[model samples]
Target: MADATVRPESRWYGPLAATPRHLFVPRWWSPGERDGTWVYELRDGASDPDAWMSCAYDKSLSVITRVGPHHADHAASAAVVPEAWPTSSATLPALVVKLYQHAFLADDSRLLVTCGSGYGTALACRRLGDGRVTSVDVDPYLIQSARDRLAAAGHRPQLEICDVTGALPGVYDRIVSTVSVQGIPASWLAALAPGGRMVTALSGTGLLIVADKTADGGATGQVAPEPAAFMGTRHGDDYPPAPDHADLWATARKADGESVTTGRYPVMRVNSTWDVRSTLELTVPGIEHRMESGADGTRTAYMLHPDGSWARATAPGARQVPTVHQGGPRRLWDELDRIRTWLVIDGDLPVAGAAVRIDPDGTCHLSRSGWSASIGAQ
Candidate 1:
């Protein structure tokens, strides 16, 4: 499956085909729906070799290795964890190839890439040679485990336990990250050798930022047309617990708000649409989304922001208009509708293929069709 997904002419094809993905992830978290909640079912390779082989080689499937701090290997056989967020995974093969393609590596380019399952790092070593590949991860265990697996695969590359957003270990011609970041880390700009390139996704959005280092410790490029949403980078073994939003959730779920009106469109889950979701996220970051469908063919969508704003919309069925309720200081639904309106009128959102300019302080300016927005660095 991996060989078919990676084009034969590409440099990464050979490496991706040669590496054994199952070796790096002998046990992984496989998500399944149980009742109304999501659960992680651990899949051990030794127990189910056929199922393991099928999953390991699937081109588009990412096998989750850790949920918060609970590693799949540490769990008892047949364990099922409910409502736990995945913290780490072996990234899908095609996406890894997409990132490498965006980097535009040359034969002599020294590369620094993120290490997740060690599969990507192995591919890099196979394509670019072990001496030129350097991989880093925030978790020491991940780094150590990747090093051992990579060695077992007959490749020894530099592996370090370092936060990708912090100061890097050495200079390199390219730095690619599978994890997303809220902003362009200043350290990346500083560590990139002159004229180097980077490919990374913006946090909370499906924007694939591709940029090249400049003389003044900044970068200039544009967002790719393709959208990608990688897991956000973490500073510790597990992400710091999410903040309590019970009060806000309760209001959004049931309470009548300060404003009520007929919505312009039907109740839609913004997260399910890449273009609309990306535009909305860029317009208003940090909005949690939830959607539920009733047995009577009614659909309801809720949007909650950290700033005490909440919005809920409901529609009786497909193609039916929705009624919206909003509360708090800001009208969260209005912002989302405004972005959607822009898309409807202009035929597309500026976020797709927008020009990106990163300043020395890590402030990213995105502009397209006379519209511009800034992210990060205040």
Candidate 2:
């Protein structure tokens, strides 16, 4: 009954109905904490199945398995949730079936998938036998738990703890990743068998890209039918802090070189997809955006680039205009204005059609309709 709402009704539903949800989740975690109270704790699933099943079947929710790599084995019945971030989770079933069906897995094809809470891997294994399935995760504990869960219900696929960011254990006919990646790693390209298909979600956007491995260095494909968000692969327990906003702003505002503009758009959110992210990324190139709201009543946004191109826009509260300053060969504001101009002329921009050319050094150029933007590692 729970799996029916997800999609592409699974033969695995009987097995899913058989296994108790409490055994897998044992606990849950929210994005940040619930109030000041941390909800990262294991909720003593040994005593309660209804509560766990309700959470498990929540179509839009992700059930946290481990918080900061803290497993549920040693925690007490009424343990307080940990404040650390979520490391592994059982993704919502809807997304699970979405990615799988996108891969277009053939009856005979071998599949490789990332095992987080293992719920996803189990679904695939159920569709295709254990011999055709392989699941990998960076956490040993997750791999072990998934192994037990799968075996208990009479399934055995390759369960390895290798990181998804590196070389896979074996060549696969198709690879489906539930984790978003910063970029398509060359290792994945190398590990992929000829003519095989791989589906992945890019790191920064909700877009899910489905591509096939080609003879050349690149893969050719299009975005998937639906959107998905996967936690990116982490080499370590935590990520390096993002660049400081205030410091970048002060530096950009102080620099003197290129021309400056007074006003056009008010302080806009950078991540907004409408026309903002495109314009800013186009105009600013490699520069990053920073936003700050101070207790003294000031809102500022800073754009910084490795090329020393920078811009700062500051405004007073909700009303009024933002003062702008920038430096470098390019006037960052002028570039943004140009992109906005393009958006107004044409209703929408093409992302996949955004001409993507990669250099030997791995730098990427995104050019569309005469406007070009470059992306590279920091």
Candidate 3:
């Protein structure tokens, strides 16, 4: 995984190679489906040694440790649980390096990093020494488990059970998070030492914020050139249940919209297109998406918002312009088409490489190419 993720000359390469990733993740969850419902099939490293090494060493695959309230370590052998949001994971090695690289850690930098399965923390401890690293998690079980595994691996970083969005344990020169946040937390700004740096990704978007502490207590930086994502932070065993959208879904499927017309572009699975999805999310936050396909090569897509707005589009074949239906106070489909049109006119979206200015209160301001957006604290 180290060779595949970073060059041998890189400072991170040795740490990545030396850290025992499998020791931190002895069991994990793999997604599957049963009778049309999503489920999580547990994978135990002890049950299959070869599979364990392969998965642990995979540079691009995140090992899911907790799904909803069910943790892999305490699960029955070969147990399959119903699918829900993933609560914790040992992040993919390559992505962990990306986050660390964004931080630009120095030999003497005191680091505070988010801990899930402790693998990334182990890597940091190896590179910077255990005394300089501190790891925090909201789940007590995860913190305790990581403490034990990290000790067995011959590294003992300070592991604390605390929410990433709350008050931190101490001031640090660097703060890096493997989990996503809706916005910068005010507590983080308070915990960062003078001239400190922070690296984190925003929830529901691919934007990676990297900023250096300013004399005035705010930070200034820019969005990273590359896009990355991680599971959102959770304050409890599981995230609150997603908003109930049953009636909105039914309306999107059958009810005629306030406006119906031919779409300017072909039907798209918006969620999979990172740039488009990220821009749309910045423009119109909190929109849920769904898609379906028929046996005859027909495809349909739906977008629902919390304000009773919805959009539906259907295309007879790939690359075909879709017929669009939109309802409620806002034209959701038109908004999407406008963003797509902007992407076509310009070479790329402005969110990438945008300048970021974070206030002391954790409000984020991003601007690029005359376009600007702001994300206040959630």
**Highest TM-score model number:** 3
> Where does candidate 2 stray beyond 4 Å?
1-22, 32-51, 67-85, 240-246, 249-263, 272-341, 352-378
- C-alpha lDDT of residue 159 in model 2: 92
Winner on TM-score (2 vs 3): 3
Write the residue-wise lDDT of candidate 3 on 1-378 in tens digits: 788999999999999989989998899999999899889999999999999999999999999999999999999998999888899999999999999999999999999999999999999999999999999999999999999999999999999999999999999999999999999998999999999999999999988889999999889999999888889999888899999999999999998898999999999999888788989999999999999999999999999999999999999998899999989888999999999999999979999799999999999999999999999974
What pairs collide in candidate 3?
A: none
Question: For each candidate, what TM-score against the reference?
Answer: 0.97, 0.75, 0.99
Cα lDDT of candidate 3 equals 0.93
Candidate 3: Cα lDDT at 182: 96
Give Cα distance to truth, residue 364, candidate 2, Å: 7.2
- Give each prediction's root-mean-square deviation over alpha carbons: 1.2, 4.8, 0.9
Give, for candidate 1, the lowest lDDT window spanning 10 residues.
1-10
> What TM-score should be assigned to candidate 3?
0.99
Residue 40 C-alpha lDDT in model 1: 88
How far in Å is the alpha carbon of 173 misplaced in model 3? Answer: 0.5
Best candidate according to lDDT: 3
Cα lDDT tens digits, model 1, 1-378, are: 655886687677788789998898999998898897789888899999998999999989888998888888788999989767688889988988889999998998899999988999998998899999999999888888888899999999999999999999999999999999999999999889999999999988999999998898899999998999889999998888776889999999898899999889777778888878887877788899989899999999999999999999999997798899999998999988888788889999998889999998889999999988899842
